[model samples]
Target: MPSDVRALLARHLPGREARSLVPVGQGLDNVAYEIDGELIVRCAREPDPEATRAEVAVLAAVAPISPLPVPEVVFSDPSAGVIAYRRLPGRPLHRHPVADPRRLAEPLGAFLGALHAVPPASLGELVPLDRYPLADLREEAAQEYEAVAAHVPPEHRRLVEDFLAADPPADPLAESPEEAAAGTAGARLCHNDLGAEHLLADPGTGTLTGVIDWTDAALTDPARDFARLYRDLGPEVYELTLAHYDGRLDDAATGRVRFLARCALVEDLAHGLGPGPRHYADAALAHLVRTFTG
Candidate 1:
């Protein structure tokens, strides 16, 4: 299969001799292979027109404006569900935390600051958020809550359930219940799935090399970008990251971020319960404890 994939991708990489096609990545939505040492070929695991379109479009638009390097789409054939991009340098951040989490926080924050600042009009079409008239989002979050509730420890169950409710108190952020219910403060382009796995950095220097995987890129509440910051790093790093942002997220904007944080737990818990290596549910429950109690 790898050889067949290599043959298929040969026409795309015209000059460089294709040396090896190594299976490198398997994310929820995509399966990726490293062709030679320089490029990546990815195919969707499921039919997602929006994700495919985003990959083809968002990368080109954000490349010049983003503070960090993003993948350069060398070739794409979405219809065939295959696209190859020049693999960016460095390893996933989780494999190697930035040497200086403090300094790294600023640029990361600044990068997102710059990222959100790019004119939305220029980004072409991206997946829009599941916003307003909360019927759908509420239902989805409830489903996630149902899946995770039993796994949550007793002490944290109430808090997680509260957040899972169709309407819950701010718990931490958001201006009002009404605003929280609506799920929109200000909408902008978002990586949608910003996590350590998608962030690449130099193992030696911790210098961030790139922000990859824009398949879920969308025009949504900016907080979606920051949801993982505090959970993955720490408050200090989270604050520093936010401090460097050029754009301002007001009470409303930030409120949505917090709201999304709660909303996102479903996926987090699911990943933990699913085939992942780690028991994310434990961490997920711990996060909930901090959210309400801390």
Candidate 2:
């Protein structure tokens, strides 16, 4: 552990006995430490106190109403961009193979249903509107595909090219004059980064355990989350997940989900080939074949 981290723990947790303290994850924005396998302490990589504060508040707001367990803030020092919470159970779904993947569908659906039901206005101050337009996603995916296409297998190249040539789905939030006028009228509270790396499950039974990493929570189209589910887990689980979801699932939403899933897949593949960790690239390659072929 770094000297600064040790000092932070010494100052805040004066008498608590910790058998072990070790770094667990180092992402672009934060460094996380596991304390005795029970607590998670995360410190922001940048000095963004406001963002850290928002994450703390969002976790508090989400914990009570979430269908699955979410991290609960136990200690915080927003000025330092540090917070600790009791570690929720289960490993990230991407890292652990579940005995029966189908079993996770219902709970995953219910979890998303609960999140989408929360009025965006309720968490108006803490979460910002996810302003990333679908056009931007398409543009980025195209750029990424250009860089990584040579590495992709010949069999999958045509599928990828076809996706790139296709027109994007209509934006459900901006479809109608009334919805456009209302500004985020069709939007909902969303776990805007609901990828497999953030989803947790029981390795033995495939039970949904918890969701983590709320830094990307936002007021956005619900289809984005659905897209992530489809990209990471595949169609069968995605369809079953939707079966349990109680929110909007019309043709427009389905179109957005499909389009967004493809965009995300391309982005992940590119990242995996670049500065991202080997696991990211490995997972993306596996999903790419599964996503395009299946």
Candidate 3:
């Protein structure tokens, strides 16, 4: 642990003695630490204080409503840029790879379904649609593509650029009227980043125990949750997840899913350009090409 982090924890945790602190893996923006034996602390690297506060607020709102286990926020001090939660047992789903994809698909689908059931109206004053609009996502992707064009193979670059150029279908998903009805029908709070790494599954039974990381939780198109299923698990698991969701996927929802999947691909390319860029970029371009051309 950095000396500064120790000082920060000491300041926030008060009398609790942190016998040992070790660096734990974190997502793009936050750093994670396992402190002592009972607590997990997350420190935000981003300057925005609202980000940490928003996560704590969202967790508090959704804890009772969500069926799956979500971390309980023990302490949140935005001034310090730290949030702590009681650590839960279980490993990320990606850690214990299931030879049978179906096993993973079933639990993942059910967990997502349960998460999506939380009414949007229930989450008071959390991040709104403007923070993660489709238009914004598109613009971000365009910028990222430009930055990494030189790094990408010319063939792949052409495919990605062309797909972006094609104006996303106006009525590609559902008919306008149907979409309007769905919107008015009421939206649900969704875990926008429901990837394998964020999910914890039991090593023995392969049951999902907990869903961690609420940094990207948002009240937006519910279809966004399915994007991870398609991107990570492919069509079979994607279908299973949709089926388990127990909701009808109209043309609009299907269209939104496709659009979001494409957006995630671009977002990954733009933001995750490193040693792993080649793999992620290739997958994104491939999915975009296959979906658009097919």
TM-score of each: 0.81, 0.94, 0.79
Candidate 2 per-residue C-alpha lDDT over 1-294 given as tens digits, one digit per residue, 9 for 90 to 100 = 466666777788888767788887766678889889988888887757888888888988998989999988888888888888899888888889687777888998899999899966577588988757777778888999999999888888998888887777666556467557768756788888899888888898788888988888888889889888888898888889999999865568877887788888888878878876567767777888667655
TM-score for model 3?
Answer: 0.79
Taking every candidate in turn, the Cα RMSD to the unseen true structure, in Å, is: 4.6, 1.8, 4.1
Q: Which residues of candidate 3, in runs, are more than 4 Å off?
A: 93-97, 131-136, 153-159, 171-186, 203-205, 274-294
lDDT of 1 at 55: 75
Q: Scored by CA lDDT, what does every candidate get?
A: 0.69, 0.82, 0.68
Q: Give me the runs in candidate 2 sitting further than 4 Å from their true place.
A: 174-179
The digit string of per-residue lDDT tens for model 1 on 1-294 reads 576466667666656567777888776667889977888888876756556766777788888888899988888866656778888899986556776777678679878988888665555445555334334555677887787677777876777666655473232234456546755345577887887778888878878889988877776667768876665554567678888887857665454455556666566777778755354555566566554332
> Least accurate stretch of 10 residues (summed lDDT) in model 3?
169-178
Candidate 2 collision pairs: none
Tell me the tens digit of each residue's lDDT in model 3 across 69-128.
889988877876778899877777545645566676666666666767665556657855
Clashes of each: 0, 0, 4
| Best of the candidates, TM-score | 2
